[model samples]
Target: MMDSGQNKNETTCAAAMNHRVTCNTFEPEGVPVQVRYAIFCGQSGIAEYEFYLSPTQHGCVDVQLDWLQSAYHQVLQWLNLELASGVFRRFLCSDPHNQAPELEAHAFSNPKHDDPPCAVSWVGQPPLPPAKVVLWAQHIDDPKGIKIKRDGATLMLDRGDLSHHWTTNATGVRKHSSFDQTQCIFEDYEQYLGKHDMTLADHVIRTWFFVRHVDVNYEGLIVSRRELFEKRGLTSKTHYIASTGIEGAPPMDRAKVAMDAYAVGGIDNKQVQYIEALDHLGPTHVYGVTFERATAVSYRDRKHIFISGTASIDPAGNIVHEGDVSKQLDRALENVDALLKQCGASLSDMTGYYAYVRDPSDQGLIRDRFKAILGDVPVAVVVAPVCRPGWLVEIEGRAIIAENNPQFPVF
Candidate 1:
């Protein structure tokens, strides 16, 4: 029902993280493919949104699910902001080239895409359209010192001692073993952060596991998340949380495993840090996996970073450009730009990066190699599958630089 209304293919002025937001790019005028996004607006009025939808008018996935439900309710009615978190990348079993089953709101999955980015719509065969699809969403701008809500599948954001979460579809209560349902889903994520008293080795930063047969249940979801992060103290001498188990099929058929988490509460553990170049990769518990290929928090102006689920491997971690998917995506973007230069941030201060493809004909050489060096810096390609198998491709991200540092405070 988007009977025309939406225009603006430019609006740049992102000296963000300290100017409190101003970075946008849209192209809705009749919207026939090619939409970009960006917006930082940090500090008190907290803001974030970065989309990358590229379809090129081959329309009909019901006109790209009505241009993703009219750009998600036109950004909740033109920039009032609401969707606190998101992830939508398609083209697996794809095709919903419509003849009937239409009406998609958050788009993808002729039958769903990502609670991991779709809550209902995860077909196995019978849905159509998808010669290509790309999306990676996120929206926010909850001012008045913030405080947004929604708890059954979670999406919250507060600010007053901090508290931001995005807890999608954390399945598995019982259906037998995939390692005791990932240890009862990490003991219900430490009892949902002990009703807000927080914990999970002090507030998880990022995690997205979706295992259903990830080469046979990713070793029981990595030995039940490393024995529930070594009974909550995350070991290997402490610290581990920043992940992406990969391969998804989550429609919860007795849940083999499904999760999505991003946490935060308060801060200063010295504004958290754990990004390491380690001479370009190695230290995911040296093979047994624990997680943390990237993580940086800081805040007083900026510094975010995230980034897990990278591939290519080397520096002793083995598997480097084996079957060569363009030299394993240039050694997984050179180990994510050397883990964003160990915190000084790089890769042109990424605000978006996502490319997980395990052969969908290597999606046109991963879209001409991320449009020749991330032209407009916002990439989202899907088809997921990289839990190893000589890794064909993988990459995950988030970045926000700036930083003035007045002893932490504005996140």
Candidate 2:
């Protein structure tokens, strides 16, 4: 017979979208690791999770209370650990660290798709005590190494890589989808949040939504997305968030939706603060005309450029050299060149970028163009329709400047 209050693996189903959650027992325990299947389904991800508990886990309460409280608190401590550690630093610090955008979120999203969510408990607990962090999110695991905070500014780097393996027929209908869009996104996201200590209302700053067919159903998606936010008593504005939604292709031939997101918390740490650009821009030499944005947050001696999505658009926002991907590519590189010069940086300073092509059939042509202009750099390309029906290409990026500038305009 089962213990009256103990949790069985089959006792209750986790919330929906948690498909195939598994809990492993620790023999000579330090920290218990919980593995979820397909937490994030794509190229770069933190697919598995390691969870550690406070020494107090086994001391108090009968079986039921112990299970509930310990699960809750242990999750909280993990999130703080992630935050203290800073988000990007965690990925960079990992062994065989893959700086590729998609690879970054590999270990965090698992159990690709299961109904009613999956969850499990570890048998043995950690011997060490838990350290407390103020104003933390409990739903997400260890924040020690997963946060970006400076000058009173707080940014939470949750899993940022997601992709859809999608293929379009002549009519543009997605023939096969590896996973449903909403289920995949919410499942992985909620699981990450579950291990953190913050309520849904805190720690989420802005969201960048990349949809496979953003151009086709942009308004409908936003309305539905906002409804979900409303259920939590969080409005878009109160979150102090901004979003850029764009269309892009998924990684494989069966994905319906692919998304990458960013969330920030806390205020600027100092009156004179600096912010770093979090997105990736391609290398400058790759295109005939390069493009970049001028807005940045400056702190200390470094500058972070938060660039907007650019395409073959000229200074007038008019599409340049349409129907000729090669010339358009050149024009794009030149734009980037101008922006780098304006910011006192150069092509070598580019951190990362997102390149969207109108047609995947032209990938080879684009690749050659990239090789010619930008040189080989860390970049990811997507095939998607542009925001404007007339535009055939678009790109955007992030860059850094080493010294504080006295001459640039703020905002």
Whole-model lDDT per candidate: 0.65, 0.36
What digit string (tens of lDDT, one per residue) describes model 2 on residues 14-49?
211232222222222232221111111011111222
The stretch of ten residues in a row with the least summed lDDT in candidate 1 is: 120-129
Q: Scored by Cα lDDT, where does model 2 land?
A: 0.36
The 10-residue segment with the lowest total lDDT in model 2: 162-171
Candidate whose TM-score is highest: 2
Q: Give a tens-digit lDDT track for model 1, residues 1-411.
A: 221243322232233324432334455545554556666655444556676655555665556666655655554445445443432233322432332255344334332332333322232221112423444566555455345565555555666778677776577757577788888877887788888877877777888777666888889889878877877778878789888888766655677777778888776678889887888887889789898888888888777889898898987888886898888888888889889887876676777666777777786687578768766666666666788888988878888776678878777
> What TM-scores do the predictions have?
0.31, 0.42
List candidate 1 segments past 4 Å from native: 1-10, 14-18, 21-25, 28-31, 41-49, 56-131, 135-207, 210-219, 222-224, 231-268, 273-296, 303-404, 407-411
